[model samples]
Target: MRRTLLLLIGVFLASCQSGKDQKEDVKQEPMRTPEARKEVVYQVFTRLFGNTKTANVPWGTAEQNGVGKFSDFNEKALAEIKDLGVTYIWYTGVPHHALIQDYTAYGISNDDPDVVKGRAGSPYAVKDYYNVNPDLADDPAKRLEEFKALIDRTHAAGMKVLIDIVPNHVARNYEGKTNPNGVEDFGAQDRTHMEYHKDNNFYYIPGSAFAVPNWEGGYQPLGGEKNPLSDSRFKEVPAKWTGNGARSVQPGMNDWYETVKVNYGVRPDGTRDFPDLPEGYEYKGYQAHADFWADKELPNSWDKFRDIAEYWLDMGVDGFRFDMAEMVPVEFWSYMNSAIKLKNPDAFLLAEVYNPDLYRAYIRKGKMDYLYDKVELYDSIKHIVKGYGWTDHIPVVQKGLKDIEHHMLHFLENHDEQRIASPDFAGKAELAKPAMVVSATISTSPTMIYFGQEVGEPGKEQAGFGSPTRTSIFDYIGVPHHQRWMNEGAFDGGQLSAEEKSLRDFYKRLLNFTINSPALMGEYQDLHFFNKELNAKYDHRILTYARWSTGEELLVVTNFDEKKSYQLDLKVPQELLRKWKLSPGKYSLEEQLYGSVKSELLVPAGGAGEFRIELQPLESRIFKLLRP
Candidate 1:
């Protein structure tokens, strides 16, 4: 009886193994697929990303003001960010900068308070290129390794990582303690006697010494706290130029005195000391720019910055967001970006250039992949949301940039912009829903959102450097709303209100759809004219447009009016009907977002398709066509 039982058990195990092998033979091969649509970047202030503290004393010391650390961004936190439909995670303020905090035991020097902006220094005023901010790491000695682990974790969560590259300036007390063996600090090989030289790393005033600005208005360095280094005196002969190119030894208090201007062979006069690009070089590619700089001699500052950028890239950074890119000469960018692309052709390069006229020049010549659309789209949307502008200007902005619309990255808030929920701005976060829908769907360019914008983080703190309405990038403080979502590093929205959770839900749906849609990267057509013809009472605050690709079509309409609801008979133009080859028929118009909302479209014999849409104040709808 025992032998018979053993033989039956062996037969049963063999049958199970044969079934598993059959299932494996029929399994499909896994493959990597390209991203379907344009990317979405979520910008997070590294110091404020995970801090849960609420104590925000003005001019507080580091202990009084707790900070977020690199370890806070573990696998679970990163997965939550990825689930939010983000393609790139921009970790702002990651570099080692001059701050009032003392790190002397680690062989690093503390910054003088008269120069540093806040207890935590400005991230743009970089102190060392090869090292990260020690304040961001649990183990200060392992800061760089911690950041590398962050990069690895971000990639593991299927998101790219970007950090800042402030090429135009560096900290006033620039030091390179963690630089590699062959690297030298800026100004280490400079000739300080001359005002300008082709190879000098800094611009200098001819015959003056650096002077700290005279203080007034109840403002003192360290808020009147006496320190051994806060004697209010910094010694310097032949003062270097300020970050804003202030030539005087005594720059105004408002000037960027904490940083020094980098010399890129641009002389005190308005002439270039290095070789200029060939005429019409803006239309060329990175390879052409690379060839142009192949045999040319560049300045010392350019070489230094290139080395710094390449060092970061070699450490697995996907890209860089350039701060004050226009302040540096375009010729240097042509050389630097070419070298970068040669190393990593798919690197994402974004520049902060505000001038509208120089947009094309910087994009085409400097090889920048994207630029902040702050002055145009963001400004216009802000006015419209503030009840100062009309929706008619939206088409004008889009038409004016028809040729280069793909290069503009849209954003409603960043480290530099005011919070949308601030009283100085729209005073209501919900009022931005329509504007965000338009910003994300209007063009093929990318879209970015600040860390707490979705949960309505009001920048109302009395931090040291700046006032309310804009989050202080200079202070060590907690972002209240985002911290709630963080939930003591759980990264769950346990403390969020019902309204805040709903707002976040809307954002999730819209952003997830954005990353999955193919028609978003296809052709666009404005339907405002056709819809206006359908009803003279069609609200001027309402805008309509259409986007279509080979097998997909989408019609997007937004109501920007916060005080009035709108019900209009929207019309599709005859030109579009002929192009789409739809005859007289009825079709279902299903709302892509909030799938329960649906409408019907009536196509008359040889004419346009008309549909009636009712939108609440600041409501947006993305309708997809389905067969009747």
Candidate 2:
């Protein structure tokens, strides 16, 4: 009787479940893909962005000159950043690193002053791979939650997040306190005595203890602060190699003394210990790359970093900007990046590789999406801005890097570069207008600007670790010009002078156009040759170039000469006209950048198109061709 009752109940439950399943058979939502748009990365130093203190005190602690927290990146600040047309925000100094500040009360260990760089330590010297800097948190215990909330807020504002991933080296006191279950720290499973093990996290000299370097240049850790751990001594059995590849027991003061080099299956004899990338693997997808490693044995360090990166990605971080990527072997990047992409295909991978010869190898094999164009494009533009290089050389650089031009990221100022308005650089912010135009419009590559660059932040502060010219990344300091725009977190630019406001407005216009223009990502044609021949009055300081796509075209011309204005009658070549198939007629050429200038383009019968331009000193004109 009981069995009969159970059978009847089961039949009734099954009938109800079938009805609910029918309701769930609706149309499935389409999978979303990442949008294809020109990227503009705004690199903001997280600790310094929202700080309103303008004490300008040299070697000051966080108390004397307040530090910016993660909470400071409020909706107003992010909205203002979006207004400036930033697609990605590279929040510098996100990872937890060795610092002089004492966070022992939060169950975090204290870093010795002898091994730390400044009051706010070097961001590159990462100490905990699983956590963010407690200094950036509102409450030290909820640092990770705070960062995750920031990521959510950033996505809400229509911008992606990018943070540094220093794979080449780590802090001298590297630890992973917040690592997940079953995950080990970097050196936990290593054989330290071998010094050449394929699985060891760091290269070490057996039987030697690490020593602190002799102080020089009147500089000391914490500026010779009176502390118990500031005794200018550090102890590490079997001294590891320094970040700059110094294998000495004691590295020099000028070397990267606070950090130790990470080993990536490379031997001390300069030969790879792991499997080499297969030939003709340049264009393979990430799945193929990841599959190649499925059966193969990789070094433990590679797996460890891959896990660390996946951890961040799983925690809602979008991408990484690798620091000193060349220091690590390319094979390791192949393994690590492939694993990352296998998880999330849209992860943006950018690297800092200065060697021009290694650019293609890193991009094709290592799967890097973008590289810094500092040595080639940035150096050429800086020379021109300083009245040294010629505009003719600019076109040559553009052509020389034509194959990988889109992969090269252009920037005028970063954390490591000189500020545009500094005396050591251009001395006047107006001098950068022409260069900024060229840098933004001259290529298909993404353009980056430092945090305070738009408002002309001359980094003339005598901060602790570094002097003026560039903002101090190692010190706890405030940026005066950027603070005026911060306006006590209102982000309204209320205190900016008229000149500063005009400069910022120009930046806004240029950046907005860069992300929206279709012709910028199109094909390029040099107009200098035809312009020089058609008009004898064409000045050498003036540069002319054309970019076009189907139904859209742009004519970009700039005056590099800061002291002279030029009246140019630039002619579009017949070959380009034939390629564009532009008929013999008059067309309107509107300046798209500032939206204040308009002119006419005359295309006569069976001849070239001629456009008259009146360029002022430090002027850049991006004229879009439109049908009349």
Candidate 3:
């Protein structure tokens, strides 16, 4: 009787399950991808990073001084950033800057607190790569802890962190001593250690004045209106020092940066008249920091440099944004890459090689994972939008990708370049949302968003080397007043415009799409771009291109013509893409859909209403193939 009852119950349950299963069929959602695939950045100038001072120490002036302590970083503002869904937060000027006796290299102290006019100079002049600039070290070790923690939070929340590092130059503010392992003092000692020489500096051109700072108005020009590099006059008065192989190298062995110009020679015993040591030890430059081979002295400098990098990584550095990485010897990078890989293989090493043309040089060298795609920005402005002529450029864009196997790190704005609102980035008269949106999704390398980029960061001209230089005025432009932007001194406060909010949200949405879309993350999808032919007449304008990743294939078509759409068709891998093309007759890509979709299709300009896919005159789109 029990068996009979069980059989009946089972039959009833099976009948109900069958009925429920027929009701509705659901498709499983695709795996969510990380932000790295279509990354964006929020760049912060450390001096102008946030609102509050690092520590409670008084900096002497509210607007003029640099952020005081290493521990004072703004958190409230960062919280909002977390929501924006950007992948990277790059901090510039974290290490101490260069300084003369006291005054900042430039005297124009305006709205920024981290300027530290009389404090340290700019972050570019790296005094000690290991020492965190005291101004930004709000919580000392805790600050770094929080920094790395921020990366963790970012990654957990879907993001990455990158910090700027200057490898080519040392801050004049370093305080390290001349003895073994050198104890760092900062700014004052920085002046005593940092020097500029033409030749020994470039590695390629050490003391040849090869790197004359193109002192635009923002920076102090090299002395005598002549770069210590350009003019050899400065080399006449070199410092006479004993340690660090100061004199062992040939007179012209080091660059101007390495040789310090001294007022007088000093003896090791504290006497005014110093003696000549191993070689004809003349005071070519003094107080000018220089490095020597392992045979010269202080066999630990290289290790120290490495240690600085390791310290940051261990302290929570997600990645390093190397400053002037091109100038650093390739051998050093080989060591860096090997070591960094051993420490953390995923650690990102983004070199600041602003020139896209120079991309190969840096990539060939080890230790680098990414570099700027400046050419794209230039093309986006001059040809893609301005349409000065090279109207339908597709080939050029394609060739640019030959060197890169994966994606490229693309950007429209950063600390060094104009923000999105800058004239160059303003592109067309209309809001080219489609253009930018498509670019963000389709570009080869990952994307980096400038700090104020999402919200349409405003730019205002301040003094740069006595001339006016424009920068983002987040406080003046669209922003809402908050403590982080106001009295607490955490960040530049401002209200967000409707456009900014919408743009920001749209970007977030786009990221969300990429994260969840199986079509986008596909490795089989290939990248494509529209560049003018090599021998074509007007080669300067128009950068039309596309990238196919995963299931979604992207094509970016821009009418650099500023006013009109430079209409064009695409060249696809017919053999591969044609397999999925519409039939020869009555074939057409109607609206967003075509007659019949296939695994691959080459929509060239024409075929029974087919083959060629027509791009809107001034717009672009990323096509996701729905395999039939």
Q: Per-residue lDDT tens digits of candidate 1, residues 445-493?
A: 8899999998999899888885788888888888888988898888889
**Steric overlap count per candidate:** 0, 0, 113
Runs in model 3 lying further than 4 Å from the true structure: 1-36, 52-76, 98-120, 137-156, 176-301, 354-358, 375-383, 389-394, 405-407, 424-439, 463-494, 510-546, 554-562, 565-576, 579-619
TM-score of each: 0.93, 0.93, 0.60
Lowest-lDDT window of 10 residues in candidate 1? 15-24
lDDT of each: 0.84, 0.84, 0.41
| Candidate 2 lDDT by residue in tens digits, 272-350 | 6667667655567688888888888777888888988999999888899999776677767888899988888889889
State, as a TM-score between 0 and 1, how close model 1 is to the true structure.
0.93
- Candidate 2 weakest lDDT stretch, 10 residues: 15-24
lDDT measured at residue 112 in model 2 versus the true structure, 0 to 100? 86
Count of clashing pairs, candidate 1: 0
